[model samples]
Target: MMYKHFRHGDLLKQWAEQAEARIAPRIREIEKRVEFHQWRLLEAYRQTGVSEQHLSSSTGYGYDDMGREALEEIVARVFGAEAALLRPHITSGTHAIAACLFGVLRPGEELLYITGPPYDTLTQVIGEEQDGTGSLADYGIGYQAVDLTPEGKVDWPAVQKAIRPQTRCIAIQRSRGYSERASFSVEAIGEMVEKVRRLCPDAIVFVDNCYGEFVEDQEPSHVGADLIAGSLIKNPGGGLAKSGGYIVGRKKWVDRAASRLIAPGILAEGGATYGYLRDFYQGFFLAPHVVGEALKGALFASAVLEAAGFETTPRYDEPRTDLIQLIRLQDPKRLIAFCQGIQAASPVDARFLPEPSPMPGYEDPVIMAAGTFVQGASIELSADGPLRPPYLAYLQGGLTAAHVKIGVLTALDRMLTHSPSESAKLER
Candidate 1:
């Protein structure tokens, strides 16, 4: 109490005394909470170890064969799907969404993506201007995306207005992968889905459920999504899975969606059977722990960067409802440097990209972000190219508190080295 009144060295004794008085009792509960999850995760890890054994020895069936089956079970059980299909053949979360779109929405029919300003890939996949023969337009699919506003949210009126009679599906990309501002909560999305259903019950509601799986035990599937999509090696797999794609919900939609997998039959590329039985299992096992750790990373990144006089989105430790954290640097060069700073801390990275340069195929020059997810974009990392103006950079992902702290430190250190006083000035 005296320490509260005066500022001096003996204050340390009073501070320690008060801290013990305040925290001693809480320690047991905190330890129990932490240990309970830790042990559960350890058990999950053990399960993963066993699964790895089976995964390696299992042959003739090959990687795809085992992975798809495991994933199907994981999706059904973990995500609460009526029927689930896992395809190791599909590339990423976006690929899974496209498959669902192509499978459910017929060519010449209208399809609406309610999630505005989704990943850049969505534009390419749905637009006719780029990606040559790959656009949804090439296949005769009429696609429209309703972008969010300056408040970083969907234009609900616009979403309602965009619906057409031919609309087969309304896609809601729940991924905050590229966005630093905000994302839809499962309940919020559920509200939107319910409203959309009121408008058109037949139209499927598809959510890009990446960076979203297992962050909370109950996912959108629980809230009644027609279909939810994500990648295996991301949050679901807990940094343990090698590869796979997920599409779950609405049995009819899933059944129809499978048709697009491996060309409709004969399991062309390892035959579209819920085949990969193991990776899916491992993914579920690691998801809880990995997600918790990833949240910790996000919080820590927010803490450090915000302390460094940099602006951070999601506000860090206050209350994280999601996995990724965005540290916004309005300067484009600072964004690149931030990305490079994070890479310096990654165990797997040898080099990091921090510049917006042209690539072989991309229409715009994007400053590439590398997150060492086994299949890419797990509870991984990201750095987005700015849309315009101040050109903010987004830094996100840390599967563990330690990793998040180190990554943030490395970024801050790198940033310090490039300050105006410090020489090695970044290209503005």
Candidate 2:
């Protein structure tokens, strides 16, 4: 409402008001959970006593680095894990996950994705495709997957059948990734852990925890996961961290991931912080509130778009465990227009229009609107989707609920008034 450059300002305002009213109660409940986690995180930091001395880097072996060790302790405490590894060298969520996979599995051992195939970037890592990339398959590891049922729930019988004697680990993606299915909840994940343990007593259960942190009172590790991994620039970074990722879980498993992250001999003893300590600490401190805002935005967007006849996953009133809001536009041109509109509402790149084009590690052309200080930061306002069938747009993150509301409203307006036919013509 502050900016009047977009069309249907009056209609958008009216919808926003109604959407706010509808979601107010849920937002209040979410605030309480946010407060609880914030207190827990603050207590963890307090117990660790993070100081300026601990913030500096230690090169070479990086042995006895107080800040590095303390940060790991704080992260472990927050996630209810025996140990944790938070590092700038860890890179993206994919890298963190790859470390865990490589650290735990060996040649001839299998990695089973019980929650179906993971995000596109992981297809190469899991050896689902050979793209000249070094993957688990390239190293002689094996892979398997069990798709979800039509109702979007885990196919438990199929899972039991799929687990093999050589299965070394069972990977469950907490978030839905790019799928239309709902993200797994902590309670559900806990049940899954029990079932898997009953079937495969010794199989390590690893949860790919990207986009699912700080949104709930309990984490996957708290619910009996052997290992969990996520990106710092996603839910936990609070829009301040430049780049990093974290892995937390059983001490032995985390140790293995650390070994893979650097080297078997060096492990967590190496890898300098490189001046990312202060931002990482502060970003984690502010994460709870930032996550609440993003969750509120997702709920609001779901409410508004579903009412407008678009198919949105996890309806506004439904329980949420992640920040993604998938809107099925069902039209390629509409999807393009929606992304462009979201970019226009961005604070950073408001003037630039997004177009579908080839991006690395993706099968189809993808269009993205990332108006973040840190490139590809999902914790900030951004919208992106693969340009293919189903024509869905994955909308995630907003530093504040107000920012999300404005951007989502602007996108809806553009979708309604903008000519998809004209956009389609341009596609030629």
What is the model-wide C-alpha lDDT for candidate 1? 0.64
Residue-level lDDT of model 2, residues 131-194, one tens digit each, is 4567898877889889999988889999999988999999999998777888999999999999
* TM-score of model 2 vs. true structure: 0.95
lDDT of each: 0.64, 0.88
**What is residue 343's positional error in candidate 2, in angstroms?**
0.9
lDDT of 2 at 41: 92
Per-residue lDDT of 311-398 in model 1, one digit per residue for the tens? 7767643434466666667766677777777766676663645567775334556675565756355466544555444556665555
Error of 2 at 72 (Å): 0.7
Kindly report which residue stretches of model 1 are placed more than 4 angstroms away from their true locations once superposed: 1-71, 129-132, 266-279, 317-319, 351-354, 359-363, 369-377, 381-388, 421-428
* TM-scores, all models, native as reference: 0.79, 0.95
As for candidate 2, its clashing pairs are none
Model 2: which ten-residue window has the lowest total lDDT?
419-428
